[model samples]
Every structure is written in C-alpha cells, then in structure tokens.
Target: MEEKYFTPEEKKEMLALSRQLLAHTREIQERDDFKRIRHIISDGIKQNHYRRDRYGINPTIHNLNTAMLLCDKISPDRNMIIAILLFNLCKTEFIPTEELVKEWGDDIAKLIRGLLKVSTLYSKQAAVESDNFRKLLLTFAEDIRVIIIMIVDRLALMRTINHHPNEKMVHDVAYESNYLYAPLAHRLGLYAIKSELEDLSLKYTNRKTYTDIAHKLNETKVKRDQYIAEFIKPIREKLDATGLKYEIKGRTKSIYSIWNKLKKQKNDIDHIYDLFAIRIIIDTTTEKEKSDCWLAYSVITDMYQPNPSRMKDWLSIPKSNGYESLHITVYGPGDRWVEVQIRTKRMDLIAEKGLAAHWKYKGIKSEGDLDTWMNNVRDILEAAETGPMELMKNMKMDIYDKEVFVFTPKGDLYKLPLGASLLDFAFHIHSKLGMTCTGGKVNGKNQKLNYKLKSGDTVEILTSTAQAPKLDWLAFVVTSKARNKIRQTVHEMNNRSATLGKELLERRFKNRKIELNESSLMKVIKKLGYKTVTDFYDAIADESLDINNVITEYEGLDKKIPDAAEIRSAEEFQLMTAADDDSTSSDVLVIGDDIKGINYRLSKCCNPIYGDDVFGFISAEGVIKIHRHDCPNATNIREKYPYRLITTRWSGKLGQQFGATLRIVGNDDLGIVTSITSIINKERDTSLRSISIDSNDGIFQGFLVVGVNDTVALNNLIKKLKTVKGVKDVQRSK
Candidate 1:
C-alpha cells in the first residue's frame, strides 16, 4: 500500500472530524489557535506530506480522530490537541520544530519532539510486551501528556486496524492493545478506554472466543436487563426516600474480563456470576462524598443482604491510581451476587477519565497519590532485574491488582499489592530493613517472613543483624522491588565470594612459583566440567575445590604464555603505541577529548566493546579505565569520584576484536548448545572463546564469551541467537 491523494469522501470525513474537535476543544483552546492548528495540518494534507497510515487511512483523518478521542475521553488541554494534530507535519519536517515552537509555545514543541522519539522507537519493532520497551517509551515521553496522547492515538489505531490488509500487523496491534495500551490506560485510571481497548483487542486476536462470549451475552440480555431493573427498583425508592441525588448505571463487565474469568475459573459464560456491575454515581459535594456513599450503602444493604467478605472501601484510602469508590457485593433478586459501586460525581469523573480528570480536581489528595505511583513505576522500570516478560507481568500486577493498605507501628500507611508477604512490606519500607528482616508482627501477632499481609494490619518488623536475604526469599516476595533486591544482593554476595576465591588461588599460585595464566585457568575450570565460572570460584571459596587439585589441573593443561615484555599492569600500560593507534586510526576512540599520548584500556569488569557508549575514569593508579556507560561499578565510581569522570566517544569502528560475554536462557532442547555454537561459527571475524552452561528442569542458562569487533557485531549476534529454536532471551552479560 502506498500514500494516495485524499478522496472526496476522506476530505468530507476530515472536515466533519475537524468541526467536532473544535467544538469539543472550545473550552480549552482559543478559536484562533484551533484554526491555526487546523490550517497547518490541512496545508500538510494538501501537499501530500501526510502519508496514509498502515490501515490506508488518510493521515489527516487519523490525526483528527486521535485528537477528538483525546478531547472526548480525557478532555485534554489546547496544547495536547495541537500536538496530536501537528504530529505528522512535524515528523515529516513539513513544519520544522523551530517554526512550530515559534508559532505555538515550548510545551507543544516538547510534546511533538517526544512524540517523534516514540515514533522512532516504534520503527525499531519494539514489542509492547517487553518491559524494556515500556521503560524506553516512558523515558522518551518525559511529559505525562505524551503518554496520554500516545494511548489515545493507539485507541484510534486499534479502532481502524480492521481496514488493514496485513494480518500480521493486525495481530500485532491487537495484542499490543491488549498487553500494552490497555494496561497503561488501567494504570492511568482510564477505565472506559482500558475496558474498550481490552474488548477490541480480544475481538481481533481471539474472534472465536470473543464471538462466543458476545453471543451468550446477547442471548441473555433480556434476562439480565430484567434482573438489573428488579434489583435497582427497590434501591431507587430507598435512595429517593433519603433524598439523595444519584444515577445508577447497570453495565456488564467487558468481554475481555469475562474471557479472563472463564479461563481462570474454567466455567462457562452462563455460570459466571458478577458479569455485570451496578454503579451508583451520587451528585454530592466533596465533603459529603463519604457520608452520602455510606448512606447509600446503608440503604442498598438494607434492601438486599450484603456479602461481608466482598466489601471494598476506597473512600478513606483511594487507590494508588486515584480511584475512590465504595464497592459492595450483595445478593439481589434471584439470589444473584451483584457488585454495587458508590461514588460522587467528581470521583466518578476521575475514575472514568483518570489523569486528565485529576487536573480538574487538583486539590484532592488522590492526585498526589497518582503522581507518587507514577514515580514508583519509573523506579520499578529502572531497577527491576527480571527479564522483560517477567517485568511485564509485574507491571500488570501493579496496574490492576487490588491494593492492601497496611500501616506501620508508627501509624504510617503503605499500600502493597494484594497477597503481599511480610518480607514485601519490609522491602517496601526500606531495602536495608528487608535485607535484615527476620519476621514481622502483624497487628501485634508474630508472623513469619512468608506470611501474607491483610489490609489495615499494623506491622512491626522484627530484625536481626544475623539475618540476610536468601535465595528462598525470592520465592515468596510478591513485589518486584523485593524480588529484584534479593537477586541483586545474592549476586553481589556471589561476586564477593568469587573475588575472595580468585585472590586465594592467585596467592597459592604465587607461592608455588607458578605463573598464573588467566586463559589457561579458565580452560582448566571448564575441563573439570564446571558450568559457570562463578560456580568454580564458589567451590574454591567454600574449600570444595582443593588448591592442590586446581594446581595439578592447571599444570596438566596445555598453555601458551606471552613473552615477559608483553606482560603489563594497568600502571605499566602508559600509552597505546604508534603502531596500535595507526592500526585503528580509522575508528579513533577519543579519550579525554583526544588527549594525545595518554593511555587507556577497557575495564575488565564491564568489557566495553567498540561503539559502546563509554566513560573514562581516572583510577587511583593514575591509569584511565574505559567502562561501558551501564557498567555495574559505573554508578558507584561516578557517585564517589565525580571529578575523575571524563567524556569518551568513538569516532569510528575499531579494527580489533573485543571480548564480549552473552547470557542466554532457553529450553534445554536437543542440540540447543550446537544450534547456539553454530551461529557463532557462521559469523565472520567472531569466535567463541569459552562457554559454560547449566541445565535444570528442561531449562538452561548459558554464558558464552565471544570475540567481536564492536557493539554492532555483538547486537547482531544477540539478535541471531534470539531466533534460534528454544532460545527465550539473549542478553549481553554486564
């Protein structure tokens, strides 16, 4: 499909959409500003600068739809609407950023730039299911408005995806809507958009299931309507007697939600209860919201028997996403369990519109709660140690999970996910507390570390210096923060043990008058069948691998030692020779702004390859160490010695190969190892250095060191490995 001039029909639709948008946005934007925005987009459309989207929809028409969606769904401000309308123009450079900024203001310009960055990210085929992609999207979209606009834009795309001819693209967009955009809408409290996106996604991706459920709901519509009417009649009379102003809505759960229930409960649509919910939106003042809701609840419960176990109170403590409502499940007519939600008009608006509505109710404390939650999301994205898919699951939990509000002994309250354990609470409070927590006393009763916490429990953490994070703790902690912290601590401990073990072996080698060859020692370890270098070092650290045994194995191994003149320490390596510089002159890596004759070597810790983003650190030994920007030690070094940091950049690719290690996890299928090694062998100027793999329960984790010239080569190799059968994830070993 290619871009075509807009047909007469398309032009008519665009004009109508433009008018609707202007009408809806009148409250937020001036008439002149809106016209100016429309004129720019219209000019771009005439010039054919705005190409047709994948669905073959006119670009101008699509932008109008997205802009109107933002207006109708979120009631966005003038700048947001302008940004979406002008996104394509700015992207195509028909209107340069400077011109747009001059015409508009800084805020609109920033939004366009962010939108462009996210568009570029999409070009890389970033999967929505990957947490890394989500983090990157959030990073590029520094403004929350950017995220909101993208969600609305996706809603527009999913709405029109059916027109696309590419089945694969349709599937991708549908799954992306379900797994990514829907969760985002949920997190932002866009309940209506979230549910609609979910339903649309389900309809496209699983048409059979969607149709089956839809058909069943349609067949039972009359019966369902009758029951709802019967249930609301008595409550309406009772509410009117109390003189409360309210509108009760009877709505069925979204098709996606019903599908989830059917799969989870292994039941048919006819058997699933609570498919529909009753929302009692009261027109009350903010001060009277709670009292009116409680009064309505008293009236409803008086009419029908309420289930004590199913009551949810969010009025006292609103949800992290700023949702405030009182939920009750009661046995209505025909002994049906029906969920009833009570909330004020303002609260209902916030619940439906999410972050956008928060602007209208800025004085409410829930807005701050939403802001804090977004910050926490950023932290989780940055600090999480799990794989992309696992982090995605954790993010979904954060978005849609029921919150349990627990208090500290000091009366400070913390909101955790439902089923959060005692250890999760400790970690949520402070990482140090989590590290040393022995157990906790919940509501003044002693509880074990694995004890699941309930709402309103005042917890006092019991700690001991002797206690530390364990591998077992990872199995129980429900929060991503707790799980990541445990894994990080355990990894650091193992590294420490490995370091001590290495030092011990080195000392022994020196005592034995044996020159320690790093490469030969690695060969010896592998020959002894150790699957990981860390395991080898751990064995030695615990005295399981005897010094005599290691020494004998090292002596027996075939080895090659470089000449004595070639051996040098970081102190001895003062500069790259003329020959060295000339060989790689085409891709000169400038150290310290091209300080001539100064020496630097890539740090062994992170193994910075050519083309890797790097920084130079002046070590205590007076030698400059080049490290990857994301080096594990980079954070500590930068924080402690800010003065020693120097900017580094690569002007071109280096000719020499660099040592890079990859950590691969996949199923332990037959010949999986051979499949991996074959790919490495097929690459030019790339060779496998060493490999160590461990298998358990049909899954394997392998570390393969390879020699590559640059980060490009390393990335390409990783991509190829990812395509291998049974390979789940392949990542550079930091």
Candidate 2:
C-alpha cells in the first residue's frame, strides 16, 4: 500500500492557518514572559520529531498557533501560553528533555502538567488499576488549570480525529471519552466540551448505529433545516424588534447522541426529534440574564406549544458543572418536538471550558474547598484496602455521584453527592466530626445520619467526642470517605486480634521451652506449609490447626500407642488401613488355618492414616480385601451379606504418611494455582499422585490427591490453601 500523507491542498490550508495563528501570537510577544515562552517553543519545535512532521520545517509554527488560540481564549501572556502548549505536546508525545527551570514562570505550563497527570494514556488493554490510578492523579492536581488542558486536548483530538487510521483505536478513545471524559467535563461545567466529547466518542464506539442515524437525518436534512430555520425566524425577528442582542443557530445532535437516544429508547432514527435542535445565544448583563431568558422562553412558547415536563429551569439553579440555560421542548412543524437552549454568551463560554474557565475567570480564591473535597476521596480509598470491589463501589457512590446542594446550620450552601446521608455531611465537615457522629437535624428537624438528604436541605450533624465509628455505620454511609474510615477501623481491629494471637502463641511456646526461630518450631511449621508465623498463630487461634496436636505429633508418640496386631488380624489391618485413620480397626475372619506371624503393616496405597472408615473381606488367596468406608465395591459386598459386616476403628500414633484426596474450587486469578501447590509442599513431606486443574467460565476446579502424615496434617494443609488469595473454597474427600 502506498503511504498516505496530507494532500497538497490540505497542506496549503494548514500552513496558511498556522501562519495566521503565529502572526496573532507575535502581536503580544513583547513581554519578557512571552520572549521566554517563544524561546521554549522554538527550542521544543526543533527537538520534537512529531512536531516537525505535523507543523512545518519550523516546529514553532504549530506551537505558535496553539499558543495564539489559547491566548485568545484566556488572555495569558502570549509567550507563556506558547511555552505551556509546547510542553504539553512534548510531554504527551514522550519527547526527552532536560529539567525545566523557572518553575512558576508559566502558569499555563503548570496547568498542562496537571492535565497530563490526569489524562488517560492510550492503552491496548483495559488497565486493572485505571480507577485507583486516576484517583491518585487527581489528588496531585492542586491547580484547576490541569483540568482545562485536559479538556482542550480532548477538543483538539475531536477536531482532528480524521487523522487516526485504526477503527479500534478510535472506538477505544471514544468509549473512554464518553465514560470518563464526558462525565468529567459535565462535572467541571464544560457543557460544550462535554457534549462534543460525548458525540465524538459515540461516533466511534457505535459507528454503525451512528451511521444509520446520520443517514436518516441526512435524508430529511432539507426539510429539517427548513423547519428549524422557519421556526427560529419568528423568534429572532421578535427578539430583534425588542432590541435584545441575540443570535440564533440551528444544530443537529451529534451522531453519537442520536444513536444513544435510539438505543436507549429502542426507537428508529426517525423517531428521534431532539436530533434537530436550536440554540439561542443572548448578550445580556448578569442582572437581566434571567429576565432575558424568560422573555425568550415566552417568545418561543407563543410560536410553538411547549412540553411542560420537558422544560429544564437550569437558569434558577445551574448544574454542578456551572451550566446555566433554559431548555424547552417545543412542538414544531410536522408535530415534531424540537429542543431549544437559551443562554448568555458568558454562560456558553463557561459551559464549554468547565473548571478551567472558573479558574481563569473566578480564580482559586477559596484554596481549601478543592483540597478538602479531594482529601475526602483519598480517605475513602484508604479505608477500602480490604477489597478492590468495595473501594470501587463506595467511590462510585460517593466521589462520582450526582450532586445535591445542601446547606450548613449557618446557611452556607454546600454541594454533596446525591444519596448522601448525615454521616457523609458530617465527614464533609471534618474526619473527627464523622468519627464522632451521633445524630443530626435536617432543615431544623431531628434526623439520623442515615437520613437521605435532598437538594436545598439544611443539615446539622450532631457529634460527640464520646461517640466513635461503628460497624453498623457502613450500612447507611454512601460516600467513600465514610466507608473507608470504617474499613480502616475494622482492618486495625483485625490486625490487633492477629497480634494478640501471635503473642499468645509465642508465650505458650516459650513456656514449653520451644525456641521460636527460623529452625526448630518455626522451620517445622513452615515445612509443614504455612505462609507466615502470623498465619500459623491465626490458625491455632481459630482452632483450625491445633497447636497441641502438632506438638504431640512432633514429640514422637509412636512408642506409646499399641501396634496394629493388638487391634486386628493382618487381613483386617489391610482393610482398616486403606482409610488412612489410625483410630479405627476392622475385624476379619480367615477361612484358612492361622499362619505364623508374617509381619504386616497398613498399606500406604490408601494410608487410612486416621479418622477414615474401613472394612475387610476374605480374598481367594486368604489375603484380606481392604476398602474405604464409601468404596463402591465395599458397599455392595456389605449389602449382599449382612453377616459379613466387619467392625473397624483407628488406633495409630501420628507422623505416619497417609494417602488422601482434596478438592478445591475457586475464582481463578494469577498465581493462585502456584500458591496451592506451594502450600502442599510446605505443609507436609508429601508427593502428589496426579494433580489436574480445569478453568472455564471464570471458575477453577481442581483435585490434589497427595500423601500426608495424618488427618490433622491434611486438615492443616486444607486450611493453608484456603488462605491463598482468590481461593474461594477448599474441601477434603470423605
């Protein structure tokens, strides 16, 4: 295939635009900061390969253009702005560079860094730690400018998405933008960027659906455009006659947005009406903003019947992202419901830029507000150490939840996530307040912390130094902050309990004169297959592993127990031993004369070490038939001849190898199979007969039939396997 490059005509347009942007930037480059920025951009362009390919021979050309555009948007010094844009592009492309001097010289550069830190890098696979990584990045972004740069990057990418070749890449980027970027944009009040990102992302992630919708819209383009133009003409004329400065524009919904509507509503493309909408931008003083919008709404309603429920009064209380507009669904020509948005130009700008606009226009005067909010999210993550699923769940509910505007007792307004309880409100005040939370009053009425707060509700959290967090608090708390705190407390309690268990074991061992070292008791415990001393102690404490039993076995008690001959005949011994339980013995009747003692030991094939049920039957050669309690053949034989039933009981000392089977089932995860094998190797001196594991449909099922000392050893081994991460269940065969 021939390599594709920009067409000559396209190159000409790019160069022309680049020169214009450069000229605009130079107009404001007289300042010292601008001179430094120009130097950096010039140096950066020369060093960056991608920049050279994208811009002209002079890399400064594109850098200059980006600078000029950004400067025009926010009146930052031209040089400083260019330097920042250059840094952003260079870092994003991974260009090598020496450390930067003059740390705070360019505010724009600082913002770019912040944005880069939070922006998701393109990856072929979904990241396992993507969510936690994002949260960590956000924690480090002290400046809101970072958020602006991120939005700008997304907008730029959308504007130039045609350059990318891979459809999957496009789809991935779109999916990310829609799920992460768009929501972020909405949160930050960048309505324009948010909507555009959503549309662009939707276009790629669902191209087929997007194409179908676009095709339908195009088929009706002429009629739709004519209706929209005619519909807006009367309103425009009326507004013009009133001497109100207003601009009217008709817009087709982004392909993605239309496609989404179709999918969500399960309707055909033709049924989607919000697709063709009109935006009315007005120039008004802040004081007359509401009045102007209301007037426009009246004009629109007079021309078309309005859908009462479809009207959104964002003008009274703007969205959390700082979007302010009056939206109305009006019945237009052909009985089509067309949506209209009325907003001032200032509102439009803020809506487009989001938090960046806020920083630029309003400045970060309230330094504590953003930091406090971020700290709350961090606290929740810390508490969620018990499990990733819990952390993700609580963080989604609390940190990324929709906002509800609430008030303090003194009447200061605060915004919190929806479904926030009084505890969340208390934590929002202070961690101490949350820890000591008792009950609270909402809107001057006494209420529990579990009270579901609504928008515009005044909340006063009651606290006491005597009170502290309880396990029950997790039930009602919605935010990560509260849940994390609760988890932290619980984790501490568990650690303390484990510590106490360890102390108890150490003290007991010391009293017995058993030195706790890497060898001797410790080594033996590890050899027997425990991960850590703490785990051993925990097992002992839980009675899963009896320390006394282990000690008794270790001390060599074989001499104290009677031999197998004293309990049963050689034939009987063979049958009872097959079950691997020393506590049981079986009686067998020899049909032949008693042969002189030919010493016989329990067969190791089925060690029948201890606690196993067994039976014996006479064989053709007068040898005893040994079988396990539930063995198929043994059950049949016992049923056929009721008088042939043999009694068996285990009565053997410890430290004897017995063959046994274990079955494990669990959710498969990395290193889990290895962990199981490791546990078996460590717990007992044993050899696996044949181990097999089959994983399908996210579940892992496996069996390990191995040789071990006794039933206690097998039980201990099973306990150890259960502790391996992601091992859901472990059971021994009867």
Candidate 3:
C-alpha cells in the first residue's frame, strides 16, 4: 500500500476524509503502479514552479480531499486524481499538453483536455449553458471517465469557493453549480454528490435559507437519529431473521433538500421529515443482487403498511445512468411516513459512485443501452436550431426530458419525452410522415393530433397526400424536430409569397419606366413607412401595393432630387423656425467692416450673390438669413411668415466666399478632378475648390466645390464635371 504518500501533517489534514479512498485504492489498484503514480504526482507538484495565479492551488488540494470524501468507498483511477490536481493548470497554459501526454500517457492528457475545455468554455457558454453542457458532455462522450472526472472536479472547486476573496466568482460558481452542475450530477445518478453540490450551492447562493434549515436539522439531530433507529429496527430484524446479510443506515436529507421539502409541504422546517429515508444495503453477488433487493423490499413491506403509490422499482430496470434501488414509503413509528430504499451492495456501489463504478468495475451495462442514449442525444444536438438562445432552451428540454418509450405498430420502439403529443410522435418517425399526417391510432384506438402519448402504447400514424401542417401546429408540437419542420414549411410559403411579390413589383417598375433594384426598393419601402423589405414584398404579392399609391410614392422620392430651387426650399425648411423679430433695413450693395460683428450671414438656402436682389430676415434663434428676391420660400415669407423681413442687398463688392461641397462619385482613378478643376480655375479670381476623396474597392466618391457666381454657375459646373473621364455622376451635397 502507498501509505507513505501522506506525511504526518498531511495525514492530519486529509487522512480521515481520504481513508476510505485509500482503502478502496489499496484493494483494487496494482500496488507498485499506485505507489509510483502517487509519488510522481506529489513530486511533480513539489518540483515544478507555477508561473500563474488565479484561484489558489492550495484549495485544489482541499477540493481533491473533498472529492475523495464524496467518491464513496470505491476507487477512482489515476486519471481522476491526476486530472483534479492539474485541472486549474489548464487555464493558465503553465504546462504544455504534449509534456503531460509524455509523462502521463494519452488517457490522462485527454481527461485534462476535457476538464480544461470546460474551464475555457465556462465564460463563453453562460448564454448557452444547456447546449454548451451538451457539447461538453459530447466532448467527452467516448470516455465516460472524463465526465466523472469533471463532476468530481466541479465538486472539488465548489467545496473550496468560500476560501476565495472574489464574491462575484463565488456567486457565479454557486449559481451554475445549483442550476446546471447539481442537476447534471443527479441525472448521472450520483445522488450523494448531487446532494452535497446542492447543499453547498445553496449555502453560498442563499446563505440565510441554508443556515436556517441547517440549524433546524442540527437542533433535532438526536430525536431524528432516535426515530430512524426505531423505524429501521423492525426491518433490520426481519432481514437478519431471514439470514440475509445487510447493513441498514438512516439517511438525513441535506439542507437544500429539506428546504425544498419545507417549501413542498408548505410548512416550517420543524414540521418537515427530519430522517428522510432508511437505506438497506444487502450483501449479495451481482447475479442475485436484483432478487435480493426485491426480497428485502418484500420483507420491509410485510412488516409495515406500504404506500403502493410510492414504490419505485428501478432495480428491475436501472436508470439510464445505472441507478438502481427499490424505494417504498411506509407508515412507521408514531404514524409518521418514512421512506425506505432497498438495494444490494453492488447496486449501492453504483448508486453512490454513478457510472464511474459501473463503467470501470461492474460492466453491468457496458455498452448497448448507454450507446443508444448518447446516440439519440447526439442526433438531437446535431439538428438545426435558429436563434442562439433556442439551442440552449432545446438542449435543456432534451437534457431534462423525462423519456417514455413507445412502440410502433411494427414492434419497433421509439423514445419520446413524456407529454409529447401525436404530432411530435409523427415527426419523430419522419418529417414527411409528419407533414402529411392526418391523425394517429394509439394502441388500436383513434387519437387526435394533440393526444398525449403514454408508455407502452403502440402508435400508428395515418397520413394523407392532401394533408399539410398548419401554423397552429407550433402551439401543440413539443420536440424541436416538429418545430423545425413546421418552421421550414412556413419559410417555404414565405419564399413563394416573396417570389410573387417580386414579380409584381418588377412589373409595376417596368410600367412606370423606373429601374427598381432591391436597394432602391428598400429605400422607397422605408420612406413609405413599411417595416421591412419582406413586408413591402408581401404587400405587393397580395395586391396591397396599389399601382396609384406606388406611383405616388416613387414619383415623390424621384422629385426630391435637389435641383437649385428644391435644394433652397429644403435647406430653409430644415433650419430652426424663426421667432418674432424687428430689424432695420440695409442696402443691397454695400460692404462695411462695422457690420462684420453682427450675427447674420447669406443663408445656404438662396446663396444670394453680389448682383442679385437680397433681403435679410431676422431670426430669434440669434441668426439672420439673407435671401434673394426670387427665393423659393419668398411668397410664404412675404404673405404669411411671422419673422420681420429686412430688405437688403450686397451693397459693395464683397470678396468673401463661403464653402460648399459637390459630391462626385466615380471609378477609382488618379487625379479625378483635373477637368472639373480646370473649369472652376479658368474663371478669373476663382476661389479654391478643395477635394476630399473616399475610395472603396474600385469605387470613389469625391467632395469638391468652389466659389460660385450664383445657382446657374454651380449648375454648369456640375454638368461639366459629370462630363469628365471616369466621373460616373455629380450631385450637390447638403
């Protein structure tokens, strides 16, 4: 035995908790190999210097000790121990994977990879925990040991959380442990480990609730122990009289569990059942274990009035995760209901350690059934899901699904979650069958589409060529397969509608002598207040896009292309509205240095030049607009406008010129503004026309402008600018 692996101080720290593991390992493991592995692990930890720190590795030792404590009176392999000690190492990249592979062989390396894969994915998978968990489980699907190690690894880390300083880490770990890890453990049949996780998680997540329930359990410990003794006395004597070797122990429910009981019972902690159950562990061989479990159950029920409704015989057919026990609730001492679980020692081992014990040691169900389950799970995972959250939701629905096995009329069995209806069943058979499904017959009786299937029912689906799925099927269908098929059908229908709509829109565009691209149509659709391009298309397909209305909208947008007058109107209208104002008249043609300090300028609207008749309008917004006499908004200003109009003109030769941008789009080329600049610069005393070029792939848009005599000169400049080589078009910028 590798007793020397633990020093005296180390023994004092962890010996008591690990004694059971040590004993089990000593019994099952090859002596020299266990000795060498333990020595190597200890030496490796001591010799190597870790260059990283996050969660302390000191707690890792505590976690391993805690894992050993929960791993029950059975051995975990070198992979489990090596992986646990090194799981935190994976996050920091402190150890190279190839080095571990060289030192520890492929199994240990693979196990470590699985653990670290989860550690790396932990943060990224929060939004998709259920699916991520499924992926994680599948990552280690080939090696059952990897999952067992992870469950234990989590157990270790969770036990050491309180020692850490990060409250947020503690809370997050506790939540994931409770909501995801603990349930996973339960599903894996590690009830003992599951209980601990739940209790510890609640301890951190809801300390007050955990504390109150724990305190209450402690207060009634003696009485609870006494009651368990009295309750099990009769069963113990009965088993002994029959000469069946068995060890009976009373089990107290965990705090979180008791809290759940309290909530379920709608009563105080004191009113809840203190001694949750009595476990009868029988000594037997694997061959006779099932019979012995039943015999034990028979003995217990003979002595006490059994609750027929509470009998759960998983012994005949163990859980998918290899959990087997026969439980019965009977009225015990003082008329209190006590639950009793009867199982052979072999079953007890499996129930305690989960699939690890079975897969490594027992080989009870080494292949067929578990493979089928995992294959089904993989199929479910591989199916297409649309939104990000849907993957997790559907994965959770599968992971937490309570399966019910039903038979086809031909005697082949199919598994579906409980509460799955006929529609889901038909879809489960085949998508074509589901799409054409008219109804079904359950066990020789006709059933509706919504009829909930039960176990052992032989379902026969009836299909018709004319039948098709309705949108309302989404309301009743449960499985993702049916939902997916239905959604695909709806999408196909939408595609057909879109095709019709596109054709109709194209015809309308052709009739109007308009070129309508998708981009242009989308712009027009949005301008007409349609929510989506699809909505616009659907309206067209349904004849909702009336020809007159479509023409009106398209023409409105086409007319909005800013010529000089429309540009003037849009600029003035888009500005802040004028308030009440009174101002003195000024000459149309005079320049004075004294007027430079005033808050007024030639408006961008009319751009009144030196020779044009101009008028100044005072604005309460602390600005003034100088407009031409024939400005677009002149009639509105003269007749009905509120702001005071100050008649004025460019009285003198004002050489000052403001800037404007002309947007010129073209294919990428060098010196695109050569001819455009020649025209503007050829004029006498021409102001600088600055150009800024933006190039994307083979396309370029240039913004350039110069001093203009009036709108006519700007117009001529734009026309001549468009005639330049490589220049596709020209437009004025706002």
* Top lDDT hit: 1
lDDT of each: 0.74, 0.57, 0.61
| Greater-lDDT candidate between 1 and 2 | 1
Q: Candidate 2 local accuracy as lDDT?
A: 0.57
Minimal lDDT window, size 10, model 1: 570-579
Question: lDDT tens string, model 3, 565-590?
Answer: 53321121111122112222344333
Cα deviation of 332, candidate 3, in Å: 4.4
Candidate 2: which stretches are off by over 4 Å?
1-18, 26-80, 88-99, 103-109, 112-116, 119-137, 206-222, 225-252, 276-333, 337-734
TM-score of each: 0.46, 0.40, 0.41
Candidate 1 or 2, higher TM-score? 1
For model 1, state the Cα shift of residue 196 in Å: 1.9
**Candidate 1 regions with alpha-carbon error over 4 angstroms:** 1-4, 25-48, 131-135, 235-249, 279-331, 340-734
Candidate 1: pairs in clash: none
How do the residues 86-191 of candidate 2 rate in per-residue lDDT, one tens digit apiece?
5644564533333442433344445455545444332212342233223333443445444444555555555555436766656666766776566555544455
Quote model 1's TM-score. Answer: 0.46
Clashes of each: 0, 29, 8
